[model samples]
Target: MSDTHLLICGNSFNDVDRDRLSTAYPAVYVDAPADMAALESGLRASMRAVAFKGHTPFGAEAMDLFPQLGLIANYGVGYDAIDVGAASARGIAVTNTPDVLSDDVADLAVALMITQARTMIRGHAHVASGRWATEGEIPLNRKVSGSTVGIVGLGRIGREIADRLAAFKMDIHYTSRSEKETPGWTYHNDVVSLAGAVDFLVVALVGGPDTKGQVSREAIAALGPRGVVVNISRGSTIDEGALLDALEAGNIAGAALDVFENEPNPDPRFLKLSNVVLQPHQGSGTVETRTAMAELQLANVAAFLEGRDLLTQVN
Candidate 1:
């Protein structure tokens, strides 16, 4: 295959994604980790970098398949799916497409907040189905302006969401790894306290073992009956069962979710809940942002091939 040193792993890559990357630098392609083993021995040994584009885990076993592999350029901001520790142990560099998609994800977080609070989806259905004409005016929805909001993580995406909310006259509160210098915003020592203090709770924590279930059952309980929870971060960041129990029992006002523990197959219970708003994890799915992300991923691969530092190396 032209002695190509690059390997692109992505079962999800469409014709456009494949063509765009393949055209930039000729490379071998594999849909999944298992398929990598099927490559010719010479071709496998020549691979110096991998451009990974899916949620599939790339562990040490997979890394071993490429003896000369030096880098793994992840397609998205979150690399929880890849075993970074395994890559590091094998001296493989890891890079992710960050800042490029932050604005899109952050914008989606804000959109979910507004959509949930205002019942915009229901309003659309009400109008489209002619219910507004027959049943009279739709019921009033909650106001987001001037509301108190608590962000679970004050990282890049979280900060963006908070900044936009500031324009809505929101009182922003957040709990981060370390408190930031933003003077007007309140900082909480823990999530329970943060949840109890706000009318809406937005989760923006990264996905990994360190943050797994950071938003605990107690935290969910603390949000109270009037609290609306919004999660745009990884699903594993929160306790799914606890959140569902709280929602079903009306322990919390409602929830607006863009990610789930099971992803495309989230709990069937969520499908039946009218109080919750659900999205198909399209936080960074915009054409402009996705194009930027792809370009960033390719840039990292190119850097590794050319003996240059990765633009956004994770490890």
Candidate 2:
């Protein structure tokens, strides 16, 4: 067998696979804690292939440094951080774990929507801070049941969220470039109109230059005072400053966010707001989901070695 080369940028697989990769391929394991800078030297040494996770960016500039790279498979559904366009231009195949994390991320989106709608965080804090009874009855919140729900993107996770909300009898509407006939749900051609019409707005759009800051101030303003916003997609999809302005000015009721613009470091203003809920971009964090993702990455690597097209091609 001809020697195949691979580089692992994150620690997802077990120790056995790490050892196996070294012997089977022209492999390199990046063990450093620092960002992509720390991995530059190791990635430069290998010419045949590479696999990475976390903040090891492979943009146009980064990809230019490695001419021999045949494939790049990410460990998560969203490959926003990676420059897929650049890789495509270079004739490299890029893949991500899509179906594996759809359900998990959908679940988180639904939960965050309910949390914000019901004011669950404020309720928990009231009791924990020992002011439950003395607070003169906590504020009332809009019920999630029977609300008009709008989704920004109607892709995998967006469709899943629509399916789950059916049990609540929610009036569901979604936005996409094209129209799709989803049972019991309506599709909106205009995202701003969808935002205006729905009582709850959930963001499920992908992140890239095309979708970056797509949810503008006008969209948020259209949602108005009684509506609540939930984002389970990339943070760049929404204008963070616009969202904060809406929440602070009571233009919208509240927000629940699972992703941030510059991940690992959300705006500090988000932490100080009582009308919003935040998570550290953990849409697909379940053990089962993560294992499935790792397995897909393995399959992608195996396919690349055998001169086969990627099973889950991105582009």
Top model number, TM-score: 1
Question: Which residue pairs come into collision in candidate 2?
Answer: none
How far does residue 130 in candidate 2 sit from its true spot (Å)?
3.8
lDDT of 1 by residue, 158-209 (tens): 9999999999999999999999999899999999999999999999999988
Q: Lowest-scoring 10 consecutive residues by lDDT in candidate 2? A: 31-40
Error of 1 at 211 (Å): 0.9
lDDT of 2 by residue, 1-315 (tens): 224367676665567546545655667676522333455554564555566576545577766666677788776787876888888888888888899899999999999999888888888888989898787668787788888999999999998998999888999999987889777688888778999999989999987778988888999999999878899988889988999999889889999999888768888888888888898877888878877887787788778887887889796
What TM-score does candidate 2 get on C-alpha atoms? 0.89
C-alpha lDDT values of all predictions = 0.92, 0.81
lDDT of 1 at 159: 95
Give the candidate number with the greatest lDDT: 1
